[model samples]
Target: MKRIPLLLASLLLLAACTAPAPSTASTPAETPAAPVETPADPANAGDVHMLTNRYDGGQYTTCLVPSGSYCVSKIDYAAATAHSMCQIPGCQHTTSDCPVLSAGHLLVDGDTLWYPYIVHSDSEYAYALAAYTDDITPPAHPLFAVTHYQTDLVYSVNVLAADEEYLYFVGNSSYAFGGAGPNGAEAYLFSAEKSTGLQAQRLRLDTLLPGQNAYWTLSAAEGRSLYLQYSLFSDNTSGVYRYDLDTRQCSPLPQLTQNADTLGTPLCSPQVVYDLQQGSITAVDVPTGQSTLLTDTFPTGDSYTYAAASFRDGWVLSYSLWKEQDAFTHQFFRAPDGTLTELPQQMYCDARGTTPVNILDIQNGLVFLQYAYDTVPVSSYDYEGNPYTYDTYLPVYGIIPLQDLLAGSQNYRKLTFD
Candidate 1:
């Protein structure tokens, strides 16, 4: 563990003692591993940041821990009076205390906080958004007061995309008497202006693709159009449907070919396709829908299952063509121009890489990555007097400029902005 000064440790303990004790459920059993300690007041840490979410006592609390020895509290309206102090060194003295927030996803636009919330009294979901411009401070006067707006379409709504003009979400409801009957789901597209509260319209996915499976990933395409990636059967030949905004129609893009019949966006657009059946890639034109074949990067006859296609200055695709399931030496490809380019040390293992892999979200030339790790148990305990095993699952969230990824660094500094 990272060494902490005796005085700092005492202060942290005192602060923690004064705060409410947050309880957690027992975790799974696992062998213990040494805790990785980071330096305190770490300034040179890269854009990699860490966020910890602990669901304890029926409430969810998230902490934003920046590089070594820095932790800040996140506050929301629900946690108006909840006081959060840094458990790490240096943070308590320098950074502003975060306010406790209600349970939901926290959206940040340069300190302007927006959370999708449901008005329990009316049981309708609304966007609880707060924007702070210029001089006004936060946790005091959330520029816009809490206003209740309703979209009389569905009950449980999960917002998929939101902008100044429109908000898109998926609403699921069961058919008929709310029994164990078949469920009906719709993709709700809502538009809002300053004068009108919210205008909503629903599009049924089943009606669009009659027999297609549940519509899962809903992403905004160019204006008024949505791209949906959904699974069909247990095997190949799924579909990526484009929902037109003007005509209110869903159609599978004309050029996407099926292999083994499984289909997914290996990378978002203007890129090559990973043919599952042929085990190769084919480039496609978004405008014309014309497709051209490309050479296979992996050894011929090697069935390399594609993982993800990340957008960078170029396309950064993740492919796991393992020689065998659960094998140590797996291959990775970083094809920039739909052409094959090899990377050293392709294989990744749990002891080295991490479980559940990682995702690359490249935004504004900044590359943000989220990864998960399994930590062994230091101790076990009983839950409400019932015996249970315990272990820790740590999730690491960080960001780096796209340049860093292109440069390929062996070392990175941690980022902490409480």
Candidate 2:
């Protein structure tokens, strides 16, 4: 899933039109002959994001390969291989006839895989959320359409976290086909019940945070709460806020402070808030507001600068260091045991040169990375006859055993879906 940052204008008007009525389409049957048991405890779920990849017991993700169409895929950890979710015999996976082809961002909750998609009919579009059983069944059918709408605004919803009762999501609205609306683009938090097929209720940002001109991002999700990081554009102040899923309450965490920096955004896990400052990493406990020094061992000289840091099961710290004359990003993995190991700079290389690898997620004792290789370059000219050239990069997903990665080994397997 991709998040396009848009300035919030006319919050009241935006919020009023955010919720659309549920569609009349009948819900699909959810019961299978043999049902898989999902954990009742919310703690089993990790933080979800608007990313292309998500991992529960196995890897459920989407990737754009050499083919122009995006394919929904699953990575088998035991076999270290990937295949498309579509199982229709002799069906081309690129078209809409394939049941699971191009399914949007995926979230695996025990036995079910949930995703959001758009349904276009004649002149109207409906943003619909659906789910299917996670099994090797031919012609997968959705268990149900949880929420559906035919509204004037174009809806793009990203499913973030789900529990036993409700699914939490963050969505934004825009005019259809880039047409301008009376109000500008807007984003909001919403929650929908699993049992009820009703339109989701938009969580009031004004009543929840009581602020104006603030930009919000759903940073992380813990057991029953979501951690939102917000920046006040009015005064240039930023902080982390917590929203409870059950009580529908929002409160700011005084212990956490978001400071502007050249380094990337700070990561907030359920227990720890990992912040990078001046070539050092600090871990702050969320409950007690206590701070612990994780490491300051990275190069802090004039030549090296901190780039970014990400946390899943552990920490992946990225920084830039001058090599000969060009600056290159160097990444390191800090294990839960306080051991730090340098990671490989590139996942693989072709004629386009070495492609840098990014840590997507760490789950089920595996590390998921996303890399890309450039395709053919396209050249075009403007009306003024000025020449312009651009290259399109196709994304590739790879997986590595977490232990091997921590041991400083680059033995990774590329996932392929034929």
Highest lDDT scorer: 2
Q: Tell me each candidate's RMSD, in Å, in order.
A: 17.4, 10.2
Cα lDDT of model 1 by residue, 139-242, tens digit: 23332222224322332222334434344444322221122222232223332221232334334444212222222334334444555433322233333456
Minimal lDDT window, size 10, model 1 = 11-20
Alpha-carbon lDDT, every model: 0.34, 0.51
TM-score of 1: 0.52
- Give TM-scores for every candidate, taking all chains together and pairing residue i with residue i: 0.52, 0.65
Counting clashing residue pairs in each candidate, in order, gives 18, 0
TM-score of 2: 0.65
